[model samples]
Target: MLVRLAVIAAALLASTGTAFAADAKRLGRYGEWESLTYTEGNAKVCYIATTAAKVTGGEKGKNSTFLIVTHRPGSKSNDEVSINATYTFKKDSSVELQVGALKHSLFTKGERAWAADPKTDKAIIATLQRGKEAILHASPAKGSDVAATFPLSGFSDALASADKACNIKR
Candidate 1:
């Protein structure tokens, strides 16, 4: 009876471990990122630091555009993140990112995309919701890739800045 009990306990531990691993994976998907803030003309801008990746097949990759908006007094500026590279997502779940002289394939799971950069030795990924927000997941892009994630708040700040600069009251 003791042997049988031990077996059951071991199985339970294994299952629990798998569950924990899955949950940990989600944690890497979305979060906050530290980026540079600058002023362009009358607009306050923010751009996340990034590197260029590669793309192929004459397909143009997607560029990182402003993603969020917040309008309040005193805080009036546009924020944007540098995509580093451009990527194109096909209907077949294949994605590609192009940066400088390099191009690489992107891995997509559901609404998320990931890629590893050989040059920078970091993993570059993004989680995007249609018509909602895009969070860039940047890592070392090389050996021991550690993701430095960035959330959507920066994008929203940029939008607010633009709106205020343009005097669009709504």
Candidate 2:
């Protein structure tokens, strides 16, 4: 299931222009996370991602859900956080990520959610780095709210692989 999700996510990011990569190469898999890199025009794109460890929701079409952090050194974008909920989000609704006491709200569009700004993205990444797990609470367009827990094991190594691959400085 995870392998399928990783493939789907890579394809989706490429097609949606979020990853900005025409072809992605797998760097390695660390625990539940995978690091990938690709070239987009002249820039290099790198990201680490993981699928949900546990998904508890009544929402249908809850497949291929995952969380990602991308780095685009050419664009000076780093630690850009995004989530694929696998279901169209409720219009104008927000998704909340909880790691310990840290909580962040991400703006939703279609099946994806992203931090409103780079600062928020940084904070969320920091929280993920320090927490053992992250729980995402989201509202679907056609069903009850859904909550997914993503484990943070090996997240640091995965992010490091992406950072090195993209030449992103800490």
Which candidate number would show the highest lDDT if scored against the true structure?
A: 2
For model 1, residues 1-170, the per-residue Cα lDDT tens digits are: 33322332233223223322111111011123222233334444332322212222222233321112212223542221123222222333434433323344545432234343332223221222111323333222222211222234343343333444445453
Best by TM-score: 2
Q: How does each model score on lDDT?
A: 0.29, 0.83
Span of ten consecutive residues with least summed lDDT in model 1 = 21-30
lDDT of 2: 0.83
Candidate 2, residues 1-170: lDDT per residue as tens digits?
A: 45654565665664375654336788888888888887877888888888887887737655446889989888888999999756778999999999999899999998889999999999999999999999999888877778889999999999999989988888
Score residue 150 of candidate 2 by CA lDDT. 94
